[model samples]
Target: MEKASSVLAALFGSREPAEAAATVTSIFVYPIKSCRGISVPQACVTSTGLDLERLQWDRQWLVVNSKGRAYTQRVEPKLALVDIELPMDAFKDNWEPTDLSYMVIKAPDMEALRIPLNKKCAAVDDISVWEWSGSALNEGNEAFEWFTKYLGKPSRLVRFNTELEIRAVDPNYAQGYKTLFTDGFPFLLASQGSLDGLNELLDEPLPINRFRPNILVDGCDPFSEDLWKELKINKLNFHGVKLCARCKVMCLFVDDTGWPWSVLSACKEMSGREVKGCCCREPLRLLAWAMEMASNAAADHGCRQPVSLVLRILPLLGTVPCQCTAPASASAAACAPLSCFIPTINQENGVTGNEPTSTLMKFRSDHALKLKKTQGKMFFGQNLVCKESLLPPRGSKTIAVGDPVFVLQKYSSNVDAPI
Candidate 1:
């Protein structure tokens, strides 16, 4: 009992047993849209999204091009390489910035850029992301030059102007909720079980960062989040608005290589599993291909890992060779090389291919939407809109890593649409 208590305390910072069906396993706040995320033990759940008190709020900042359009990993894979950091005390609710306080930004071959936390900025209108357009505060010349050199194009860093704009969630989904520079919803909730189930169908398992979920939960059945219409954590209620349709951004390589993975190819092959031992054999080939692709991409980026080391790991992965004969029961198409199905490199973005999306389409597509004659899409996570406190002094709720998640209400079936 003592040992178990120690382990629980180590993982969640509290030894209390969960009293709900699920526990919040992780909390991530992306201060800047599409940049790296900061994992926190606890965060204030605000009207917009998870926030680190006085330091930064989720998606409060954005990188924009010369035309004031947003730049995301989908357009510039190099954004994945950009890193953001803040002082440790910044996460505290009461921490006040001293004269030395700064938000440090770093990227490859670029000197660290520091922006004072208390610095004032000029508000600029014309910044836009996805379907929302509004005014935002410009971070100034230093940030401008830093991003321009890193992205190799005219770029600027802008903060969403809270005082000037109110970007509301689509009325068709959540009537009155609002968000900042997020792709759409304020909160994206994912389940560890869902990721585990998806990883079972993947060649190399992906990290939770691939989904960029703000709230990640555990101790739930795979895909159960899809049916979560309403849930609560701490003192806040979160309603599932739309089923999050994954984009190419999640397929981006999670390594320093800056190469995109073939999610389409991965999903198509791993999801099908039509051939006997396809999971075992095909994955081996896919692993080798990914390694080689990563190696080549590294070389392109002027950084290369030892190919010999990659080869050494290959033998440990499986004895399966690139050349393998399919069983009699399998179709001829099943035996074709993955490269034949799709070009190994995307000509437009230099991505190797696609996965999970192709696989997800087989089983996870919205059947209700399809029946309704609406354009159907494959979904992985749930888009959430918080039901903030109606009383005075709103956005005071805080959610922690070990907080128990209660399902207040849920759909009987995932096939049913929330709207």
Candidate 2:
């Protein structure tokens, strides 16, 4: 068995420098837990992190007890399946608008139960919701009644209050930004190759959600992200703070059908149990170091790679164009005009050129490019271009001055790299 210390040392060690800088292929944000996510071609960089302008944390709603402690889905796996909807103008109106959003949890027989919003419906009962840190949040009664009634277990609903800013444990650290209820930090990272490798060893593949990573990267080897201490996706950058240790929670069956011994046995054999409460003993720090080292090693090996990274955006929901003319105008006029750009490598190898104005950007080996309108025009593109295009290899060719390029739609997979 590989000692944990050995793994850590190998991952943290220095290696050959990168020949060329890496670029981001796509970005994704999940507003609600266990539900669909919103994908934006572009986003704004913020001190806390990337802000997609609409996508926010869905699990930000807290289920608390009468004592104000939080409850976790750990005991009730069904909680992982609950769905939430946030108000579009919560940021501007401070939860005062009559159209406050609601949440719904799926019941047996495909039934949907609504959790109410507003002060009038606030006092139903209280329940507890658990955070990743094992802390409990005591939520109101109304939330409790809504959760327990549908879950058939004692539970309650709680909303994340921006006014009640919860800061990270390390204020000076990168993750210290204010947030409601996230695992611990604002981001989570995982690799598709790592998951694929694990599935290869198992009889059946586990769903990616079993790990609950906020950021999923593709095009790299399994477990390569552990080495990335710092990364840039266009104008946005992330400084990885800690390694995410593997816990027993990973072995716990998420389908609510009881624990699966086969999966547990496989995990125990693969990663020896060191931690007590968690299933897997892998430490967050160690994992982070491993990823950083692996990425460096790959770059050193002369393999250009494509990578997909996800970020959470604030203001979970927003208003869209309605049928009414005024509302339509308002919605349409909300965003500034935007355009996508592709940066193609010129024949000179070192030289680069922007795509023709009349040509729509298309997939190419050099790189995928996009241009977002912030204060000025910002470009974003994704392609294997160097070593990272998601698509298979095509012979190297140079673009003529007047060649046409068409911008392709972004991928929707958890890891949205072009294929």
Candidate 3:
């Protein structure tokens, strides 16, 4: 017990969220699972969908290997070489409120292929993601044929169940939270300050895309995301569940989760680890109180049930062997063009194919009780779960870059479960 206590003190380094609510730095979506992403000005956040365009959710489409395992950068670094796009009016051109006819894809030697998006109501197929299994809308023969040719391996294309009710988030962190294709949650949050700090530590100043968060924020201390409890941006409320575990996908090369692992571990190891409790109710505010108030406040607020906790605090691309990063510093006038993000890697000199991009970024966070080295080494973005809501709500819940974000509630950490 004494040894465990020592580790916590070193991990919680002497730091706090150095400032209050910050601005949305960037917004990104992996339209196709594991391929590449598109940065958008706005997205409609939903419990079951990414920012909505008509009704399309981020990562609604996916690619499967011969055995039906979902193909991600975990095993296929070449997946990064593929390019996917979702134009602003992507919905207007090929999609309608009722029918999402198709989307077009392009890659090095392959001609642009327009894959249809009409399989949701069709037959279902046995598909597996990680250890979970579910039925998906298989994209039919043409897509299968195309993917097989493009990947040079047997591959199939599948869509999320249009019902948007199949996959569920880990209930331990989020109750009844549903998602599709994502490793778990519907959202991820990273901070600009964290990325800037990471750049200072690396051989090459990396781009934010290296980490792949759903949302990015600016104007906070480096690695401060690890300190967030609850957050609100636009109409959607997001809770930080766990820090995003680093994956090899970040560096676009398959070397066992790469630099991000080192980055997250550094953040996890430097903090003071005493699992202290704070009032952390909505619209997050700091208070001066005595130790006596802890138990009384806990009983009054209760646990397991969520509250409004209003806050005003805080806070991907692809391919061509894509060199994508979340925006470095985004504003209305100077968004980085799509071309700037996709380029060849000049590995020798550590330069990208095009001129240096001003990328904005965020990393995953953890309520990590790092009692050991292996446990401390694998997290980056703040994993997020959408609040319970019906699939396809009556109105859209939108969030985007430049949107205002608030610190809503308390950070959650359970000492009993560290795995």
TM-score of 1: 0.68
Local distance difference test scores for all models: 0.61, 0.33, 0.51
Order candidates by TM-score, high to low.
Answer: 1, 3, 2
TM-score of each: 0.68, 0.44, 0.62
* Comparison by lDDT, 1 against 2, better one: 1
Which model, 2 or 3, shows the larger TM-score? 3
Query: Sort by lDDT, best first: what order?
Result: 1, 3, 2
Clashes of each: 8, 72, 44
Off by over 4 Å in 2: 1-55, 84-102, 109-111, 115-142, 170-175, 249-419
What lDDT tens digits, residue by residue, belong to model 1 across residues 3-31? 97886344333322345769999988888
Tell me the spans in candidate 1 whose CA falls farther than 4 Å from its real position: 1-19, 47-56, 247-352, 367-376, 389-391
The per-residue C-alpha lDDT of model 3 at residue 50 equals: 36
Q: How accurate is candidate 2 locally (lDDT)?
A: 0.33
TM-score of 3: 0.62
